[model samples]
Target: MAIRGALRELSVQLSLLNRQVGARLELKDVDLDCLDLINAHGPLTPSALARRTGLHPATMTGILDRLERGGWISRDRDPSDRRAVRISTRRDRNAELLGLFAGMNTSLEHICAGYEDADLELVADFLGRAAEAGRIAAESLTAE
Candidate 1:
């Protein structure tokens, strides 16, 4: 029960942090989410992105359009499938995006410094599994 409460708090805090960062960049939360997805696993086709995000195809189109208009992403022909288009974050904007989160990253590093190697590994492993569980839950909910 304690762990569940802590995890919920952490999730809410992280979402709020992302929302603040998104506001600074003149981006909506969903746009930031899609941008993060593209940055993490980019060069994905539009349909693939739509699936991963659980966004309707039409809504995904609007999000892609906004990102492209903001110079945050680019749409290009897929090399393997000339008929389809791929979406990717613009390389030039990487530095700018990183700069926005530099403070948070630095703070996290400081917090991590207090943990021993073994403890950090345990925490990392737990977090990885937790993230996977959350992803599966989201997928199930979307499917339903």
Candidate 2:
């Protein structure tokens, strides 16, 4: 219950931050999330993206279209498989997008600097487990 409460607070804060970033970039929440995915672990195929995001094909299409139209991302054919299309962010604006969260990232880094190495490792493990749990929950919801 305690961890759940903490995660709930974190989610609220992240959503608020996401909303602010989205408004500043003239993007919807899902669009921003797509960008985050691309920036984090993307250059992913459309099908992979849809599965990762748990978005329907049609809805993912709209988000991709909007992001592409806004010049935030680009699509390309996978070199190994020409038939497969992969999505990536526009390199020119990559720095600008990352800049949005630079302050928060820096602050988090500064906070981490105070933690002992073992404590930091524990925190990282906890976060990893929590994220996996989130993924599992999302998958279960989608499966239903």
Candidate 3:
């Protein structure tokens, strides 16, 4: 019960934080989510992105369509797999987006400024383990 309550609180807080950040940057949640995933993972196929993002394939296609129209991302046929398509951030626009995020990044850095290396390491370990547990639980639920 305690853990569930804590998780609920964290979810609420994170959602609020995301909304605040998105509003500040004039971006929709889906756009930010897609950009964040692409920035973190380099290029990926639409299906691969759907799996990674927990979005439906058609929804992912729509997201990609919007992003491409906005000049934020580009898609091309994968060289190694002609049937598969790969998507990547558009270099010029990506740079512009990165520049826009620079201020937010600095603010985040300030928030972490007081953390020691050991404290940071512990936080990372805890979050990684928690994520793994969540993944396993999700897989089990899907299997059932």
Candidate 4:
């Protein structure tokens, strides 16, 4: 119960943070999700992205279309499978994206600076485990 409450609180806080940051930067949730997905999984097909993001394939198409139109991502013929296309982040924006991520990390680190090393480690471990559990839960929900 405590963990669930904590996760809910964290989700709320993160959503608020995202909205604030997004307002300043003009980023939409889909744009951020697409960037995050590509950053974590490298190049992927639209179907693969849909699976990873738990979005409908048609929804993924719209997301990809918007990102492509914005020049944040590009698609190319998959080297190993000419019949399939893969989407990836644009090379020119790599540094800019990395900088933005680093800045967010720094902000988070500063917010966590009051914690002791062991406390921080424990929190990190818990969050990692919880993330994996959440992913499983999401997959199961989608399956149903």
Candidate 5:
């Protein structure tokens, strides 16, 4: 019960953080999410991005168009498949965007440092599982 409550609180905090980041960047939360995906495992194809984001193909196209126009990301032709295009953040601007969240990252690291190595490993494993659960939930939402 405590873990469920904590998870709910964490989800709210994360949503708020994303919204704040979106407002500060003058971008929508969904766009920020797409940027995050690209930042983590970028150069992904448009279809792959749509699948991961659970966005409709048409909607993803629009978001990609907006990001490209904002100079936050670019669309490139896939070398292996001329008909396919890849989505990726602008390497030059990625640092600038990431800087916005550096403080949060530092704080997380500091908190993690308070734990013993074994405890930290357990935390990591737990968080990984929790994140996987989130993906599963997102999949269910998309399926509907």
Candidate 6:
């Protein structure tokens, strides 16, 4: 119960932080999340993005358009499938994104600095599983 409570607090705080970051960059919360998705697992297709995000296809189109207009992402022809499009974060904006997150990154580093390597590994594994659990919960809700 203690860990779950702590995680709930962390989730809310992270959401707030992401909101602030999104506003600073002139992005909507959902758009910013989509951008993060692209940055993490992209060079992907619009359909794949929609699937991963659980957003409707039409909504994904609008989000992609917004990101492209903001110069946060680029839509290009897929090399392997010329008829399809691939989405990717713009290389030029990497520094800008990283700069926005620098403070948080630094703070995270400090927080982790005291932890032993084994402890960090355990924490990382826990976080990964937690994320997967969240994803599954979301998928179930979406399916409903």
RMSD of each: 0.9, 1.3, 3.2, 2.5, 1.2, 0.8
- Per-candidate clashes, comma-separated: 0, 0, 0, 0, 0, 0
Which segments of candidate 2 are over 4 A away from where they belong? none
Q: Which ten residues in a row have the lowest lDDT in candidate 3?
A: 18-27
Best-fitting candidate, scored by TM-score: 6
Model 3 TM-score is 0.74
**Per-model C-alpha lDDT, please?**
0.93, 0.92, 0.78, 0.82, 0.90, 0.93
| TM-score for each model | 0.96, 0.93, 0.74, 0.81, 0.93, 0.97
Better model by TM-score: candidate 4 vs candidate 6: 6
* TM match of model 1 to true structure: 0.96
TM-score (C-alpha, index-matched) for candidate 5: 0.93
Local accuracy of candidate 6 as per-residue lDDT tens digits, 1-144:
899999999999989999999999999999999999999999989999998889999999999999999999999999888999999999899898889889999999999999999999999999999999999998888788
Instruction: Report the lDDT of model 2 for residue 125.
Output: 99
Higher-ranked by lDDT: 2 or 5: 2
Candidate 3, residue 21: Cα displacement in angstroms equals 4.3
Rate residue 4 of model 4 by lDDT.
89
lDDT of 5 by residue, 1-144 (tens): 998899899989988988988888888999999999998988899889999999999999899888899899988889998998988888898677778888889999999889999999998899999999999999999999
Arrange candidates, best lDDT first. Answer: 6, 1, 2, 5, 4, 3
- Which is the better candidate, 3 or 6, if ranked by TM-score? 6
lDDT of 6 at 56: 96
| Overall local distance difference test of candidate 6 | 0.93
Query: Distance (Å) between predicted and true CA of 144, model 2?
Result: 0.9
Clashes of 4: 0
